[model samples]
Target: MAAVETMVRVGKAAHGRGVFAKRAIRKGTLVGLVQGKVIDDAEYYSDYCIDLGGTLSLEPKTPFCYLNHCCEPNCQLLLTEKRNKDGSLAPSTVHVKTLRGIKLGEELTIDYAWDSVKPLRCLCGAASCRGWIVAVNHVFDKSTAY
Candidate 1:
């Protein structure tokens, strides 16, 4: 398949830098791969790192690293398994795909599914805003926005 154009750009966001769609993107389209070096879980914190299941993380090297978290995200991360040169099966690829049709200039976001290690105060402003972003299973009092 021909590469999809670089359909996103970096821009200001409520919290800080964020990724924005440069043009309308259809639902279920593959946004792109998360390019980066894999690191052990003990590295310094960076907003660009993604948890690659226990004890491992991906430090993104591309603009896609700027994607922010949203309670109601328009994109989702999917993992694909591949055979390494050594002939071992491993989950070696992560892809970002659109969850719904997005308008030009709209922010591209993903549900971080963040765990409680370092919860963040969410300001996504979505109607279903979870108040605080924590681990997927961690429950918090939602009476007040965190």
Candidate 2:
């Protein structure tokens, strides 16, 4: 809540649509909320969806849905709890935050670790690019080769 607004814009990425910073963003600043409808984990693979926790998922409703995966990402997803109108604690929701200072026009990304059900070819172009976007455990294990 560092007086920051939706400092992001959706644009073409190397793979597909991606979120880009509209202005410089300081590290640890809240970019925006990930609005979505709560759904069961069975529907997790649907478009714009993220796992909330065990057996639950969120189908993103905002432009954050355009966010793509990167091995070296500039942003991260965090869960936060807020009070409801009745002063009861609501279910935790995911928020996007900067991991470090991001320059204007830089694409916003997150390490989609351990969440992907199947291995995917990575086009993130990071120096440490793992070639494929898969769970960390599968990265170095030859048995689970990407």
Candidate 3:
């Protein structure tokens, strides 16, 4: 394992074992890439998996993938749609680094509202932390948007 990965480990924090930022990460920097093989959403749903990005690989796992869900996230893992050479859709991810610095013990979190599912409650205890990580539209549905 790389020294970076060694700095991080998946363990229970608030909800369950979560990946934490071992070092201070700069905004817009590449935290890491999801090199795991792609799995269909169906497979993703069936597995009840904890890994993010709906893919799995044996490469050195980083704390970035273990980040829990938050209504308001410090950093964002954006999923972009790319057209394959065959004109098919391929989803890729890019990390939107946090505007501010995060301590080593802070949990790396992001809102998981891409689909129609409601956001999960957060336990990170940040003053602005929303109880749930809901869809942006739904977040506006309630009075949590600040």
| Among all candidates shown, the one with the greatest TM-score | 1
**Taking the tens digit of each residue's C-alpha lDDT, what string does model 2 give over 89-122?**
5557899999999999999999877545456678
lDDT of 3 by residue, 59-115 (tens): 223455566666556666554555669986555544435645666766666665543
True-vs-predicted CA distance for residue 23, candidate 3, Å: 1.7
lDDT of every model, 2 decimals: 0.78, 0.79, 0.52
What candidate 3 gets wrong by more than 4 Å, as runs, is 1-8, 41-65, 94-96, 114-119, 139-146
How would the candidate models be sorted by lDDT, starting from the highest? Answer: 2, 1, 3
lDDT of 3 at 74: 69
Instruction: Compare candidates 2 and 3 on TM-score and give the better one.
Output: 2
Candidate 1 TM-score versus the reference? 0.82
- Which one wins on lDDT? 2
In candidate 2, position 7 carries an lDDT of: 90
How do the candidates rank by TM-score, highest first? 1, 2, 3
Model 1, residue 39: distance off in Å is 1.6
The alpha-carbon lDDT assigned to residue 3 of candidate 1 equals: 48
